[model samples]
Target: MREDDWLAARFEENRDHLRAVAYRMLGSQQEAEDAVQESWIRLSRSDPASIDNLGGWLTTVVGRICLDMLRLRRSRPEQAVGEHSPVLADHEVPDPELEAVQADSVGLALLVVLETLTPAERLAFVLHDMFAMPFDDIAPIVGRSPAAARQLASRARRRVQGNPDIPEADSSRQREIVSAFLAASRSGDFEALLEMLDPEVVVRADEAVAARGAASLVRGAAAVAEHFSGRALAARLALVDGLAGAVWAHRGVPQVVFAFTISEGRIAEIEMLGDDDYLEQAELTIIEK
Candidate 1:
């Protein structure tokens, strides 16, 4: 067989797996197909003799392409839900019997949660948590250290899980802590705020919030406490996506939402989201005191 023919056959062998990875990385099937095609193009240009593992090489290339695509998407204006829904080709209809099975296996809800993650965080979580890829392998792709890659996946996992199955008692405790944190912030009690936060607490803000003068990232309890101290007066206790959180609203519309990650009774992380698209998708309910 010709060299190009041999490469094409091998590429076909890995197409399904590559498509699956790309689909999960990018939540759009069309984009996933584009990424897979780009990977094949890269493979075709490279010398096959120098490649030890074509599958691994192709997967990494696709991952890098998807990462770039995700970053570009984030840079653009946010799209409203259902604005760019995927449309399948006429000849691409699936078996009726497999519809439910595919839907359940894909878990569209999980994909929605994944959309909230940053590009690096999404890559780390998908590759490490879902594909069993190690942080060492993910580090180079994300341009972070292995430890940093691991941390990204850990943070993403926490957000994705959101503890929907948390016990009522635990949920109540979370609410209490969130309430206390808000109270301390409103009262400008820096010490009280610090007490509620983990020593290594991290705070992240979505692009919109950051553009509105909020810091994109804040680390350490002291810094986080200082940032929130005397600042949540306009924010009210709320259940954000079934998790104990808070929101700041203007004329009945939420302008900012605070999602907290509580660990060992302390605030381990706080994600501030002000993106209209994200807020519209989130289910927020005010908790009356």
Candidate 2:
């Protein structure tokens, strides 16, 4: 293989690992993939000969890229998918991180907790705790000393380890809740809708969807209830990304995806995906029961 081919091949070898780190850092598959791709781009443009331990180098690059992305996320209202306060005090979606080495995942609830962490804290925690990277290696990425990085990891670890028993996410219960929500929306049962939603429930819409005159971000139970109640008549139940969710489809083509973060038997947050690309990428499985 030629030099460029060799370089591309080497990066490909670390792609999965890079993507995993990014996912933990950013909590959105799309953004994680973007970070990995950006790393590849940077690799292609840099002096390949100067690099040693390509895996570590790529990891650091992705880490820096994700740090910047996480910082940007902090400044945004919509934030990253799955990166928000845990809606449920005791609920966890299937763990995605452990899917590689084990059959189970760390669950979406952990990701939500990680979102509460600052950019540096997240980087330090994910890299050191999740990937087993050393604090020394993590420091430069967050622009902190090794000791500071260790402290960041320690703080994050305490927060993460403190939540040991996130309630087992029950798909059956999820289906029922979503069904009730749909029923309430269709029948204009505002009270029922409010009951199903957490008081601080937040609903986020894609920019494209928001630009069309819909509210981009709706917060509070009353406001969120007012938006969904008497609406979503066209939506039907589906296993969005393998979790219980709802979708709005026309003639089998989905136009919208409603991803939920449920907790304590209430809808804590609803993330709306109206972007065509997001709809296309959604892994929607029609729920039969």
Query: TM-score of each candidate?
Result: 0.55, 0.50
lDDT of 2 by residue, 1-289 (tens): 8999999898889888897788777766567779999999999999999997899999999999999988888888675454432222245454354244222334567776787788988899989988999977997888866645765786677678764232346777888899889899999999999989999999987665677677889999999999988998888889875567898877888877788888898999998777664465456787742
TM-score of predicted structure 1 = 0.55
List RMSD in Å for every model shown: 10.2, 17.2
Candidate 1's C-alpha runs over 4 A off are 1-129, 132-165
- What's the true lDDT of residue 5 in model 1? 98
In candidate 1, residue 88 scores what lDDT? 50
Candidate number with greatest TM-score: 1
For candidate 1, lDDT tens digit of each residue in 1-289? Answer: 9999999999999988787788778867677789999999999999999999988888889999999988888887576424223335576665332233236444667767777889998999988877888877888899866645766786688889875355789789999999999989989999999999999999998778889899999999999999999898889999876678999998988999998999999999998888664576566899953
